[model samples]
Target: MPLRYQAIGEALRHTIAARPDADALVVPHQGVRWSWRSLGERVDRVAVGLLALGLEPGDRVGMWGPNSAEWVLVQLACARAGFILVTINPAYRRDELVHALELTGVRALVLADRFKSSDYVAMLLDAVPRFGGADQGSDGPCSELRFAIGLGRTVGDIIPFERLLEEPDSAPFAHLETISREVGPDDAACIQFTSGTTGAPKGATLSHFGLLNNGALTGSVMRMRPEDRVCIPVPLFHCFGMVVGVLGCVAHGSTMVLPSESFDPAAVMASVERERCTVLYGVPTMFIAELALPDFGRFDISSLRTGAMGGAPCPEDVMRRVCVDMEMREVTIAFGMTETSPVSFQTRTDADLETRTATIGTAHPWVEARIADETGRPVSRGKIGELQIRGYGVMLGYWNDPQRTAETIINGWLRTGDLAAMDDQGRCRIVGRSKDMIIRGGENIYPVELENFLRTHPAIVDVAVFGVPDARLGEEVCAWIKTSGPLSAEHILAHCAGRLAHYKIPSHVRFVDGFPMTASGKMYKPGMRKAEERDPTPRIPVARGSERAIKERLSR
Candidate 1:
């Protein structure tokens, strides 16, 4: 297929021309709805307003807020104005916020008054003391930061979002069109911060072509059409929501639905039923919670025909229920990270159930995927190795950090740091993260395999397996399990007895209420590993000589 070679602003213009009266955006809780034409007009107004604030092309504008119509408007406005939009996670604290601002050299910031319990205004004041006495639209502590804009309410000297919408006496509407024409598809349009699970977050610079095309392709895989209404409950700051959720809808002329400012299972169900949303998006944890609701059956999710799930592996049981109970028959499993426009592999709508659940499908169109060993040589098919990607979806580089960018992207391919195996048919199965792999007595163990096996037990609801420090063996297998009812470590070991290999059986097991989660709802394995290191609790081990005994039993 030919690539879409236009900038995001141009794409939106074409969408407006094609479907002027169709619903383009809907926020039920906020009582906001805009059709395609009206949404385009709003975006143009914001673009002009931003330019009126003395902002110019290539400036970095930071947006820190939850999923809302204003967030979507800022995204489009930045693209139209030829500014690099920097997305900040609403969950970020003072240090993270400061780091993001410093790293991107953001010239302006737009934020909400608060999200959940976070007093964003207070945090900003704490981070930048100059804001205490600075006038509205004046430079603050950071010399490059020209102004600050608040969405819901004015905070100190920050300009209110409403002011940006007001037409100035000499509005730069003509200049907005000029900038749109000058902006190229390869121009840096956005800088999104990585989750920073390992250390400090790095800004991944993405071009207009990369994001718009990725979203269009992802939407195409789900068979999205103009009539489709997509309910997006994920945080807009993440690529999964902004790139795949918002841009996906825009690319296909589908209506974008914001269930709530933040993720709420009840809100998602209500939005789908009320809006008759045909498409949905979320991580596996979101779907699990929605499925586990006490009154899950009360929601009329019959309208949900297709959707996408990513950010973590989707358990087989959860996938099955999503298909049957939630009526998302065409729901697909997407796999990728923030640096690659967030999706490299996505199960096609026509794929078989086994292909959909057992693998992450094949590489996307115009994208290449390969499994390579440590030295970066391609491994033979069906063997486990690091999954690397090279394509248009790859980011320009980590913003302003060539050293780190060179480390991640070598010879044109981005090292995903994921351990995966590909079938002869090209389907890829992510076994485990390279960092999460366990080495016990020189034998490598993939936690996902064991975790999947452990989940087979009727009492187990969820499981996360990782490596724990061991003096004898470099690392030992440890499992954290969430169960539906009472379960003993002995019972877990017995269940694994003859089914799995001796070395693969978890060396330790701990029952827990739930696993720690990241903002995007994926299991926070790094945090859990740190907690395990601190506690170092004595765990139940396999029966003495049980390994050899189980090997002999399985051999029979």
Candidate 2:
């Protein structure tokens, strides 16, 4: 049956009614644990406080902080109070923060004092110069912004998070239930900023029904039980962590364990062992780091049974190791964009290794997917094309940008810019991005395919394939490799010699310590491509040495 929760507030109320005493949230690092009933009360208090702050329904509330109890409270409080939560990435610097605040017209911002090197207070003050001197509930240069709330230490003229929970006698606390009842399932719940690799980020507006159901379905696919505990290491600002990680646990009445404010391999391992977490969530790169930890074998991860991996292409080898080494036999791979409530395809828990690793599984329930050519017409099964999705999970549109929204969504189908192919069984395999595709001398080369092939090399730890300018071919393949030890371009070319097509072989290979990554853990290719273009180094020809010598060297 389709999900019937009218709003996230209603969903939380139902969960509390069903299992009030059950453990709901656990933040080990913060030493915070709350049952469903306690969590509901806290959410109500925060919602009431938000209302007291003069924010109206449909107002934008920006949250800038790492994963913590306060972050989760703000997320639910906004939903309950009929406000749109704009999730600001914790890694955003001054310029990016200003853009997000101004673009979304965020009325109130709730942020931390500092996370790592980012001082949220300093950045806000710099973005809006008058912020430091602005009176309580007064508008600043941003115009729409009315106030600021600090999660840690209270900055000058900025309210603290604890103050939000302290209800004033004059405040309309009783109206919390009424306001929550008025909020509808179709109302905008969240405006997530897309990780802008090409240009400026756009806020993807998602509805309460879309996010709630997406989380529920994701949890169901992972076979989440009421007794299960889920450890989330991904950032809460991203959909992978908030929607699939937090909401998934809430939907199943499972315990949510926050390993830390940010990604920490040791913290994750320790949380799983101490909390006895049955489910874990992360991108493939996170799993790679955890598996590579020097003390990885010391951790007792026997409690881990199922989890979800998304946010980037999951290497086959990583998937296999996660199953065997991490003991996540039921680990699934989810694939989608931020516009589609982040998950439209996920592997089933009972799926075989080939299905789990080779494909991104079938279309989610109540969701329709098709592989379409450039003309928007459906292509034949197994043919490569852009993947389009139509479902309740699709976002309402980009916030206040109808022009871009119309360009992206046509006749209710959201055009995911990703290039993919669908099998007869409806399983989808992402074949690089349409924009990321490299066309060299009329040959279309999918970087993901080449990257996957290069990953099989024993010396390569990670590789990113992209197109570099070529005078004759118009464009040639370039591979940026992160290797384990000393490796030359000759060794890499020799490995790709017979396995891949001549045109697909990387024309240029450069060794790098690490690839630039987005906050969401995806390889930031546009910057790398631009840097390579600016340098325009001379290409080294492939070494044509004795086949016998190459084979003998490869054996060692």
Candidate 3:
């Protein structure tokens, strides 16, 4: 496939011109339905509104919300206006939010007032002391944050989201068009923070050229078409949603159907039925939840022909069920990280079930992949080693951290930190992560980050966090702690309640006298992993669904 060296805004404009009357975006729960032309007009208004707020071309604008039409609008508007869109995870709590804002020096933040149990406005106010008050700002972090554009509901000093849509007295479209032309293909467009081996998350700076082409290629692999309606249940904060789900649709002029603000199994099936969606995107656990619904057979998801699944490893049984029961025979598995525009390898729809389930397919066009030994020499095919990639998809670098960037992306190759093996055919199977990162239900949770947070408790002397095999989530977080004071599992859970995201909190906790150590005196993580694997206890109670009933019957 030929690459398109266009900025994200350029691609959006092309699609709108070609398919102005076509359905562009739909959010069923929010009662949003828009055509390509309408979406384009709203995006432009938002862009000019952002400029009206004194935000320059290179300023950072943080998007802190779930999957909503407004979220999508902000994303494209930032790209069009040349503002770096910093995607802040909706699951993030106060500290994480502050870290992201401080790290990116976000000038404006677009946030939803509340989602489910998360009161985003309250959290933002708590995190940034200078947010709503008449103070110049604090001496601490997030001093640069000047605007909090509220979505859903307006409160206190938050600038209402609807206010941005109100037409200005001046000719705003011409002003926006002038600013849009200045955004180059190589300009930094997004800052997506991904947790590393270190405790803190690093912002991976991606360019318009890299993200546009990668999303285009991903859509190509899925055989996406202009008429295809895609059901996207993934979080928009991650690349899986913004890069692949949104941009991929833009590449083909396909309709983006957001099932709900957040992932809801029933909502997903409902949207697929109502819209006759041709494509669906999600992680393994999401598919599991959808299939587990008691009334799964009621939804006419026959409209689904193909989709993309990634983030965590795909289970063979689940893949088989998806092909047969769900009738998604053409569903493909994708592999990549935030640093590589989030997709370097994706299985083709034409491939057999085993090929799709067992391996991440050949490298994307223009992407170079190799399994390298410790000496940085390419290993023979079928040998397990470090998977490395060099490609147009690779990020410019981790934002503002040159030393760590040098350590990660050496000589143009982005160290994936994933242990993988390749066959002679160039198909790759991910063995494991060299850096112990836990992916719980599509959310990446770094062990060091959790361990560091747990250690902050005065009662805890040492803590170790790792991923244990989970039947549903692919992997769930497990932690072992050595405490200086009397501490129960309840106490540890309480400590992590508000401090960390729900998924990052450990599902299983064990109190240990001491940790098993290697000869070199490092913690022996493999030993702990093996012991946990032998334990017969279910990690967590399965929710009330067909899946739970089946598991209970099998256990009996």
Candidate 4:
């Protein structure tokens, strides 16, 4: 099928017209369920209310919250109103919050009062001193932020979210149809802040054209139908939820089931059982957690037929279990960054277990993908190189940062920075990130390859492999592992003794209950390495007995 070049609002209206009474959204925790027609009506009411706040087309609107019915409303409303929706990570604190607001020039913000340990209202007050000040619209740290809508409770000039739905704004509400007509497919629909290991985060601008089609294509790969109920446990702030999970359902006219406010394993399983959801979506770590639940089999998750796993490298062991044990035989593995509307390639539902677990499938429909050498030249199949993509799914650019945009998107191709190799069949296997590759004693070592090998051990639940500084070899392998129980570094080393190359074996091993994670749930390698740098003895001898033999092999 060719890509759909329609605007999100246009596509949404089409679906509502076709499936007027079909279940569109269900938030069991909030006791809310809406049909397509009802969702469309509420979405329009919110859009009109936003315009009533004196915001115009192209203005930025930020959403800072977890997965709530309100979050979904604001997400679709922004598209309907022609405002750029900037998704703020629920994990962001004062500094990160302010940075995203100021960087995107967000004119209005809709947020939950509090979730988990973070007090969003207090954080906003601290980040923007003028938030509730006398001159609310006056110049200050967050100069462009003029309005605030609180999802739960309001304080100090912040308006309660209910007011938006109840706002008796007849004029804007009446003109909603006309307003939506003015919005085009190429208009900026969202700005997602991409987490960078270095410098500050960049706001990746995405268009309705890209997001709408990416979702449709993703849904098609999973063979979604109008009756499919998709259980989404991922955070709505990320593309994984908003685009892949939400938009995918809308594009396919499928029902969406919000499992919980945030990711809770029990809530997800319960929602699956209660809603009888046929599809599921989550990151690999999330699947691992759900499968590890003590009473995991108590829930009838057999309703699950298919799903997509992305946002981190999926372990082969876990993938196999999801198929056989979890009954998700048609599950797929997705790959891409935020800049590519989050998915450039995805495994097909009909793919065999090995094809699904070993590769990220072929390029998305109407998208061009290639593996390129360091010089930006295309590399032959079966050779590792940087993966680049050119398609409708590519992001417009980084918001207000042309210099960095120029550096990232060259000659219309967005450089993914991830190293990968394509097979003759076009299936691509991810090698680690180009920057994550370890160079030890003139040899190149991919951390993901090592991590995958370590995960094969029954005792090892999860692992993160990265390089640490070494005076002689330039860098050395270090592994941090989360296991099912107490396991020694010696035992881990003995397992890798013959399976892995000598230099690839972790020179230092530390067992931990958890690995540092970014707001988006990716392993924060830089943070782990920073903490390692603080340790006085960065290099520890590998497994006492095998130390001499391994040292001799590495020295040679």
- Better candidate number, 2 or 3, judged by lDDT: 2
* Number of colliding residue pairs in each model: 0, 0, 0, 0
User: Candidate 1 on 140-255: residue-level lDDT in tens?
Assistant: 44567768899876756788888888875543777788889999999999999987877899999999999999999999989999999999999989899999999998889999
Question: What overall lDDT, based on C-alpha atoms, would model 3 receive against the true structure?
Answer: 0.85
Q: Candidates sorted by TM-score, descending order? A: 4, 1, 2, 3
Q: Which ranges of candidate 3 are over 4 A from the true structure?
A: 134-138, 437-556
Clash pairs of candidate 2?
none
Q: Give the alpha carbon lDDT tens digit for every residue of 1-556 in model 2.
A: 4665568878888888999998899998899999989988888888888888889889999999999998899999998899999999999999898889899999999999998999888988877766677453445457788789998777667888898888566446668778888999999999999988768999999999999999999888888898999999999899988899877777778898999999999999999999999999998889999999999999999999999998776767888899999999999888888999989999999888778767899998888999899899999999999999999999999988999999999999999998999988878888888999999889899998888889888788888999888788888888898888998887887788667766788878878888888887888999789878787574454432345544565566
> Which lDDT tens digits does candidate 4 get at residues 1-556?
7788899999999999999999999999999899999999899889988888899989999999999999999999999989999999999998888899999999999989998899999988877766566554555678888898999778887888887787565677668878889999999999999886877999999999999999999989888899999999998999999999999988999999998988899999899999999999988999999998999989998889999998777777888899988999999888888999989999998887777767889998889999999899999999999999999989999999999999999999999989999999999999799899999888899998898889888899989999988898899889989999878776777788778788888888877789898766789999889989998364455632245685554455
The collision pairs in model 3 are none
For model 1, the superposed segments whose C-alpha errors exceed 4 Å read 134-141, 169-171, 538-546, 549-556
List residue ranges in candidate 4 displaced over 4 A: 134-139, 167-170, 536-540, 543-548, 551-556
* Candidate 2 ranges with C-alpha deviation above 4 Å: 134-140, 167-171, 536-556
Per-residue lDDT of candidate 3, residues 414-487 (tens digit): 99888888998889987667767677778767675566567668787667788888889988888888876798
lDDT of each: 0.89, 0.87, 0.85, 0.89
Question: Candidate 1, residue 416: CA error in Å?
Answer: 0.7
> What would the TM-scores of all predictions be?
0.96, 0.95, 0.80, 0.96
